[model samples]
Target: MLIAQLTDTHIRRPGSLAYGVVDTAIFLEAAVAHLLALDPRPDAVIVTGDLTDFDDPQEHARFRQITAALPMPVFPIPGNHDSSAGLLAAFPEIAGRCAGGRVNYVVEDLPLRIVMLDSTVHGRPHGTLGAEGLDFLDRALGAAPGTPALVCAHHPPFLTGIRHMDVQNLFDAAALEAVLRRHPQVLAYTCGHVHRAVTTTFAGLAATIAPAPAHSVSLALDPAAPPTFHMEPPSLSLHRFAEGRLVTHRSFIGAFPGPFPFFGPDGRAIAG
Candidate 1:
């Protein structure tokens, strides 16, 4: 199964720009086109939060309008920039699957089970999977012990060395690790919010933070560096499950160079 992950879209009102700069809607449109053009299109798309710049109903409406072109199922969670109410209102179908007023649910129809968790805390930049959310995840993973699973949330559960972003990362990471450690079926834990592509390990499983299809958080490793973003090449994560393993690749957006041949027409190696 192949799954595409889009995160931190930060969509705003019809013509407003994010932070007075990025036209996030345009970026998202390009991303949609990129996904549609994939040779073997993804079976599903999991959006790991920040569907809007402000948790406004109009912003959410805009998000829905842009994503309507996608034929595959699109699953989304709430990020720090989003609210549970806002997300639920935008995607009413999700409301039936959610419980305890959180957008925590599992996708069971595919070979790779997906457990999407809501880590957003109202009026807060950081994230946490409260006791309720943790319990929900534990139950979800435990239900399918033999299935390879992928856990997704908005805030990355680990630090990324980007000081400003790190401060707003998942706050209850240790608790989350404890829950995940008990579930060996989990293939990996993926998230967004940092707006950069990052990989690491958590609870003995691969963990990733997908880059946004818009601006990227400036790669400032200094502890005193201020929070900033750059108009870097936007990208998204593609997770393919094959041969009992799940692999992720960063698929960058936009056009680049040509697909030049690596060898002559005679089928021999071409020397530089």
Candidate 2:
């Protein structure tokens, strides 16, 4: 089975730009179109978070229109910029089943279960998982038993060592870790808040952050250095499961100008 993960859309209203520069909507469309063009397409698409820039009703409406043409199922959750109530109102189908509450949900995709955790605290740039959220995870993971599952959230539960982004990580991660310890079936923890491709381990399980499709975050390894941003090409991750192993591939949307060569059998090119 194949799973396509799209993160950090940060979509804005039509004709609106993000941070007065980047055109988020256009890039998002390009990213989606690229995914649809993939051969043996993914079974479903899981959008980690930051679905909108302003959480406006119109933004949500426009987002639906743009994604409405996707051939596979698209699952989304709220980020710091989203409004749980507004999202529910915009899509009654998701709202009806989610019960219009916290926006956290779970789906058993068979052979691979997905637990979508809501770590977005109202009006806050950082992330936090309350006591209730932890309890829900425990129960959901326990119910699934031995099925290999993936835990997804809008925020990274572990530190990425980046200066500005580290401060905004999930605050109550220890509590979340305790729950993860009890559920060993979890294969990996996936998130998208930092706007970078980060890989770390939490509770002995792999944790990966998907790259943003709109723009890239500045690399700030130095604590004293100022934060910066990048306007590089957008990218996403594809998770494929074959023969009891899960492999991940990072793909950039546009064709990069530079290139090398294609290898052939016997480590030599068969033709020019």
Candidate 3:
């Protein structure tokens, strides 16, 4: 099963731009086109979060229109920039009414039982998977003990070491970790928030923060350098499930000069 992960899109209305700089909507459109052109289409797409820059109704409407072009089903959860009401209203199909105000859900239709966690701390910059959120996950995992599960959220549970972003990461990963430990069936945790393609471990399980297809966060690790972003090729993550394990690949978005065959006309290696 190939599941494409797109996160931190930060899309805005038709004319608006994210951070007063990025034309996020255009990037999102490019991302959609890129996905549709893939040879082996992904079975599904999980949009980790920050779908909108301001969580505005208009932004959500535009987001829906852009994503509607996608051929595969989309599963979206909330991020710090999003609110439960807005998300639920935006994608009523995916964000179906749940008990709590947060948009937590479980999808068992696919090969992997995906546990969509809500890490958004409404109206705040930081994120957290509180006790109730963890409990919601526990119940979902407990319901299906043997199924391989993938935890999808917006915030990376572990500190990213990027001083600026770490401060706003999921503050209490310990609580979430406790729940994950009990469910050994969970394969990994996939998220986005730092706007970079990152790989790490949390609660003894693999974790991936997919790169944004809109813009990329600077990789500068300088303690004094201010937070910034680069036009560095935006990208997404593709998780392939096989042999009871998951392997992730970073798929950079945008066109480039490539695909020159390795073998020449005579079946000889191209002499550089």
Give the best candidate by TM-score. Answer: 1
A best-first ranking of the candidates according to their TM-score comes to: 1, 3, 2
Clashing pairs in 2: none
Given candidate 1, what's the lDDT at residue 243?
A: 86
Please say which candidate is ahead in lDDT: 1 or 3.
Answer: 1
Residues 1-272 of candidate 1 have per-residue lDDT tens digits of 89999999999997799999999999999999999999899999999999998899999999999999999999999998899999999999888789777999998879899999999999899999999999999999888899999999999888899989888999999999999999998999999999999999998999999998999999999999989999999999999999889999999998879678899988998886
Can you write out model 2's per-residue Cα lDDT over 157-210, one digit (the tens) per residue?
Answer: 887878788898899899999999999788888899888888878988888999
Superior candidate under TM-score, 1 versus 2: 1
Pairs of residues clashing in candidate 3: none
> What is the per-residue lDDT of model 3 for residues 98-182, given as tens digits with 9 covering 90 to 100?
6677888987789888889888888998888888888899999999999999999999888777889988989878888999999
CA lDDT, candidate 2, residue 241: 70
Residue 34, model 2: Cα distance from true site in angstroms: 0.8
Q: Each model's TM-score, in the order given?
A: 0.98, 0.93, 0.96
Candidates 2 and 3 compared: the better one by lDDT is 3
lDDT (C-alpha, whole model) for all candidates: 0.94, 0.83, 0.89
Candidate 1 error regions (>4 Å): none
Off by over 4 Å in 2: 256-268
Clashing pairs in 1: none
